[model samples]
Target chain A: MAMVDVVVLVAGDGVNRAIPAMLLLLVVLLAGLLGGRLVALGVALVAAIGFAVLLPPIGSPRVEPAEDVAALVLFVAVAAIAGVLLSTIVLSDRRRLSAEQGTVEALLRVDHDRAALLRSVSHDLRTPLATIRAAATDLQGFDHDPAARTHLLDLVIDESERLDRIVGNLLSLSRIEAGALLPERQPVDLAELVAACAARLERATSKLTVEVRAAEGLPLVKVDYSQIDQVVANLLENAARHAPPGSVVVVDVERVGESVRLRVTDQGPGFDPSVRGRLFEPFASATGSGSSGIGLAICKAVVDAHGGTIAADDAPDGGARITVEVPIDG
Target chain B: MAEADVVLIDDDASLASVLAVGFESRGYDLRIAATGGEGLREIERREPDVVILDLGLPDIDGIDVCRHLRQRTTSPIIVLSADGAEDRKVRALDEGADDYLTKPFSMPELLARVRVAVRHRRALAAVAHDEVLSVGDLAVDTAAHEVALAGRPVELTPKEYALLMLLVRNVGKVLTHRAILDQVWGPDQPLDTLRTHVSHLRRKLGGGAGAPQLVTAPGVGYRLLAPGDVVS
Candidate 1:
């Protein structure tokens, strides 16, 4: 302001002082940048009054009406253009800041999950291996005790199965990601598949009751039999782990339009509604239960291969309901 | 069954050693061959009671080996396949391999599959065409076309009768869905039809104290388990 004032005062001829026009022009741009046309007009009147009082001898600059009006119009046009550009930059800066914030949040979440996954994978793998090691070592120490031998052997077998499940799921995820798991579609009886998975898991632990219900003549879905079997088995594992001991984990299958929906309902404390979206995320179940939290993620991948959809929700009667729907024809 | 001979054709020495120990404990003789050529030679030297073939060999295509082995020997071949290689397993079955088990399979599961293959081979050789084929209390008297469970007459359709006869012939062996569909209903039958028929067979021949079990191997096929068969 002082530099422009010095230049304007040195150049002004008092009567036809046109240098104040430049100062008025700067004020007009700031007015447009700050407020709408009404406010711009108000600021212009104040600036003109200030110029008249503050400069004194140069009462008004460029008193010729035609040239003065033309200068004011030119100043308003320049002010509006500068205002639009400046506002655009400011708005864009705000948007960029928010986008960066979102990226930081997502990265933090991924980092946390990666650490959680590492912790979970280590626990899942080591717990079983440690149990098997202990049981096998103990069997060597116990001399000719049949009961102890049988118990230790069972521990070895059961723990080995647990380890196998974890390793299998992890390997499957990599294979699936590599596009190595192509679906070999075939007609399958979902009930039979569930029963087999349930039977296999039941043998490993007789803790939960599995009741698989598929209508006698339910429509057979065309899916990759092996992959779909794996998907259902993952769901069953999740349900079985969550369901209380001696409670029934209900697995039922039905056809809805072109899709066959399979649901797993557990009697244990179900998931919170807010966790519905993240249920299929890897390591979402990393609660230190020695389960491969990657099961649900693998299930999602397999189901996706069949052009299917899988979701998690709170069951009506209080428990988690994990539903998988695969098209009848893939 | 006097200790049936088991041949394992796999390069993995760890599996061979473990299975050898298991077979030894069970009084079965296990002959390990590390490649396809050696496996074929072993089979030709003296056709083993059961051939446990690995579908991944260093020398030849495992499926081709399965085909050649099928051509040379009538002994049961149980193909050992990798976990995700369902296509290879099915192809081996189509190439006349008797049964298959995925790798990383449970020791007990592998043993049971091997036992089934051995029992089926021995049982088939001992009695090729019997008038009355019975497993547990369930009998299919092909002579009179009579089906009876524990002395009670259980009537079945001709298709069911034929299916039961086929399963009876290969007692403990797991017949693939393709193999069963091809042999039973000719070809080009929907697998759903086969699954429906099998489920019906299971429902009628229900489980109890002393009844035969029609077990489904999920994505694979069905096997009829009698009391003394496949008990490893």
Candidate 2:
């Protein structure tokens, strides 16, 4: 302030003099924001004293001094600077509030999703339990034909398997969420993994057969064997649950570029475009038919843990297709 | 597989009860012991043909019981365990349990495993070292040290022959890598080399329908499937 005042005094005081003084106010405002109002007040007082020492006395009469005009210009500049600084504070405060509101909105969305997942899981678990209870309860009376009794027993077994799948998926998802499960890595053959998964799921899937067309001599993808099996099994399970009875679920595996790409195509109802966006979310079953609902979520988590990518889309021949790609050495 | 005597050690009465019903229908006499000590005493007294031990015994650690039982009896010890720990299962198998069934296993599946274990023990008891052993169309003539698949003699290297003979002797059983390595390569070989050898053998044994399959049990072991046998 003293430097600018001396310069203005030597060069004839003008409107430009107030511009430098305005910069001093901006510095004070910035200091106010950084160090609180006390520091700002101290800086402002020093600036005012500097101005007093540098400027002409109030009673001094020079040869046609334009002190009134310069004082008016300085006052206006100070008011404009103060106005902008105060608006900046208010604007920043508003931005912070909106940001916090965004966080709250996100949290609400997550809470709603959690509630939906719980409902879906409860429904899924209870459906199989209800089936098992009804079948076993009927079988206990021992009044039905042998074939009927066998069918009831089969239902109990099937429902129990379903329950097992749901429980397994929930455990896997929780482990993933807790970051407790570190995949034990191995050099695994993808074809073998698919075959093992198909064999395991064959009993549970009543009609749909997991037909694999794996390219021979696939590079041994370094991954966690059991984890990858879970991923493939979940995909096949989802396919079997959705595909029409007696339809073939085609599992295609091949080395695509640097990654091994696995695609499971089901002749079921294709993914509705609306739900495709959240298809990987837990409990987002393509068809709401008693699916454990965490299948895709498991697939996503396992594949992600392996540094791989998973995707879903409508098949060209009127079905849904889930594709997964894992690096050979990942 | 006549009506074999069995001793089951499980704290869960529900499993014991269910297995009792299952064994009765399957023509086996089951002796239940709720604790590991009782199980060992039963084994000492009766010397059953098969022992089903649940590793989650209330009184003792299942693995220690497994070790003790392995030292006490020649009967096959088929372990019952909860899932999700390959290490525990491997340790059990390494502790001399012939086979294992994960918990919540279906009745039929458990029965199948029991049958396999009994049959395995019988095979072990009745082994004549010089006799010919076969699974599906693949046969190993111990007399001549020759391996043949589908009437076609498939020449194998020493390691390959040893591996094939080991698998043939224990047909329909999942042999852990360590088990195979300990017997074939004397417990000193890397697992990756074993995998490579298996893949080579699998490629050599590749055929059309009815070919014997060296079915892979991921992260655990391999099972040789008879030509027409379906995977469990």
Candidate 3:
């Protein structure tokens, strides 16, 4: 006979008293599964006493002390065994549940991040595309004067360039994430690199004043020329976007110990305090506008690949200053 | 001088047609080639005044085309490339391309580059032997190795003088940063050095009223305004 049935039969009146003892054993097992051994033992002791008192007289009018003692002992033994067995099963099941929940939460987080990325990409790309379309439509519509036509063409060109920048940033960020950006290093004169970057930027736009200052006889650092150029260019462009009109963007380069230090300072409102820590994180833009928001991130990746460090902080004069230091080879 | 002929080498049909229309409106003859092979053949056949080459080509590599063209003729080659392709752009300039325009460039900007290229070609052909080249009040005496603004002698360092002389010689022509670096500071010199000298030259030349302004082409190069050229 099954253990429960055997216990039920021992009480003699199987219908009323034995069934009650069986129910009490089930409750004790559940308490052990949820609350451990101490709880299960306490419950079992209380139920045993209750069952002994409440059970109806099992046989003829005379109650045998030995038989009654045996019945109570059987009830307590079965309850304790059931409680111990269920506890292991319950604990393992709980562990499996938590593990599954962790995986589910991770998947949800990835989905959320992907959604945010798509939203940001679409918003950044659409603005420039819309401008280009509008400008093209205007160019085709009427017999405008040469100057007016040129103005519309300028708009189209500028907007397209903006779109190109966004696309470039996206590709660069993806390449970086995929671990494909292995910089091909060469001995590069940091002063010349900064000047070339400044000159290129100056040629693109005439508004901001880009002043370059480098210590004479700065040491040449080994770096990928093109990648370092992109870094400087990104910083200058960021400064140009944030700095007030007619403000100066200063690019300073110097030799610090065994490393080359380059700093780009812009006379702007300074780093946004709220997003300061995450400034170099992908998609963590301070403007929260049409910017690709990966400029600083790219700089950081390129710098890190070169065994260098980059940091952003507020300048003493209340402007954004970004500093990059790369060790120079002997 | 006869009307200048321009050859554009690019695979993008839409952009070519648009550029052709723009150039035609500006009174230049425009011929479009769909591939680098066709472009070289066209250049060889027509010997156009200026060649506008696209860096990304369907057949031969753009830089190779530039190197090959440099061997064949001295006609100015203006490269068209996408933005952020600075390395390739620099390589093209090194390969003897006179100037370059980043893609999505305005028609006016392209025209400006063309004008600079054509002017540079003419300047090369003419090869002025005059002792003093005058632009407004700025005079550069090649023989004396001196510069004077408004008849007053301006003392300049050798590097600054060399930079000024280059701009004066190529007045109204945009000299690429690499080109300036090559001519003034030799090859592999840093661009910042060029900028420092240029800034000092600009200040000494007087960018104030009635002075010949040292105009910047931003990302391309610098040009010294000719006496008759408008400041804008």
Candidate 4:
């Protein structure tokens, strides 16, 4: 009676253990289809170990060790295949996403260029046409007035020069974009550069009081002199154009350790919140309609070429500030 | 100062012809060239005090043209480029251009540049002969490496001295940021350092705190004010 009771208890325990082991095998098989190779391999390993531990001693009467090894090899193969498939899908999706992003950026640039071309063309063509128009208008009244004729000729000359400038800017933009533009880097004194830029700004606008600060014993920096001049000039010009009249345009330059920063701060309404992300993008002007927007974009590209970083932010004085930072060699 | 003769080169015939009349009215002797080769040939013939060379040309690369012209004459060459590439301007200057005007520049601005170029060229020639610079109360003796104000020696640092020499050398003429950088700092120093140094020099030169003798030209470089030029 005692032997029969012990046998019944062992049987009940074995049945209970087999059900869970079998359920675990089912979970592993299903997981192998969707999981990556590593995950599938982990599940398979756990299931195999669990089954071995749970199997009754009666199972020792059945399969050979070589057959068991073959079954383990087959499970590993399936897990590896699942992992490879998952990796391939993930990689391809990433590639597609980047390519799409590249296409959109290119499209945006193209649109910007087209708009710039049109704006410049219209403005340039207008000047020459205005000149010719005035000339013809004067010629029609030539017999009656010499002063009118002289004035008309002057107008023609002025307008023609304006057209020339427009054409020049268009060509310049192309060269810069094509990487054909090269800067003659040299040691430049910031104090003089700022002072010069400030003087010009002072003369150009009554709307802003321009101030320049250059500390004593500042070190000279390597740069393309004319190019930097253009950068500073464009910034000041942009500030003068955009900042409200009677506001201040502060052009400041300072040395940080291992770097130098030049900042052009303006007292006017700051950047439009909508286009902040795209501010450095070509033609992404904060001023809604009138600004070329290419000015800041070109500035950013030029600074980048010099291995410098440019950023725009609201000024402490409550306007816009454009800061350019370039690394100095140790 | 009397008006100076200038040689203007561009392929645009109508525009050139109109500009000729305009320059004439402004008391300038103007010569026009339609091509790079012709402009070069013209430069050899007259050696005009100033040459306004357009970058877009039929025969030669504008940079090459600038190089060739530089080899032939010391006359100030002001490049007129349609491209705003800082690199292009730097290259032009490297190739011997003294300055540049981007496309769509204001006529008044262009004329002002021309005037400065002519004045600068004459100034350079004068320095080659006289070797001294006198502006307002400041006198720079280039040969002696000396600066004096009202007959008193003004002490300056090595960098300040170099900066002063550069400014005095090109007095009344705008030196671009790159040009000044190249002249004062060795070419290896970065631009931010250049700005920092310029700031330091300004403070040292008494261009501090509202009173400034040095002037900044927007999108360009620096210029030391000429005599009688008041700063408010």
The digit string of per-residue lDDT tens for model 1 on B95-122 reads: 8787777555555666677777777676
> Which parts of model 4 are misplaced by more than 4 Å?
A1-78, A98-102, A105-330, B58-61, B81-87, B102-109, B129-131, B204-213, B228-232
Predicted model with the maximum lDDT: 3
Candidate 2 lDDT by residue in tens digits, A180-282: 7677889999998898879877777657867899997899998999888888888887787567779989999999998999999999988868668888887
- DockQ, every prediction: 0.01, 0.01, 0.01, 0.01
TM-score, predicted candidate 2 vs. hidden true structure: 0.43
User: Of the pair 2 and 3, which is ahead by lDDT?
Assistant: 3
Colliding residue pairs in candidate 3: A192-B190, A202-B218, A203-B218, A203-B219, A204-B218
lDDT of 1 by residue, A1-330 (tens): 433443444343443444665666567557655664555666666665555445545554543555445444444444445545555665677789999999999999989967766656765675455455545544454352565557557767876886788888878878876888788988888778888888888855366778888866777888887788778778777776666668888898888888888999988788855556687887765541335478998998889888899888878998888889998877
lDDT of 1 at A214: 83
| Candidate 4 local Cα displacement, residue B43, angstroms | 0.9
Each model's TM-score? 0.43, 0.43, 0.55, 0.50
Compared with the true structure, what per-residue lDDT tens digits does model 2 show for residues B52-84?
887766468888999999899978888876434
- The candidate 4 chain B region of ten consecutive residues with least summed lDDT is B203-212
**TM-score winner, 3 or 4:** 3
Candidate 4 residue A149 Cα shift, in angstroms, is 4.2
What's the lDDT of the predicted structure labeled candidate 1?
A: 0.72
The lDDT, on a scale of 0 to 1, for candidate 4 is 0.66
Question: Of 2 and 4, which scores higher on lDDT?
Answer: 2
In order of TM-score, best first, we have 3, 4, 1, 2
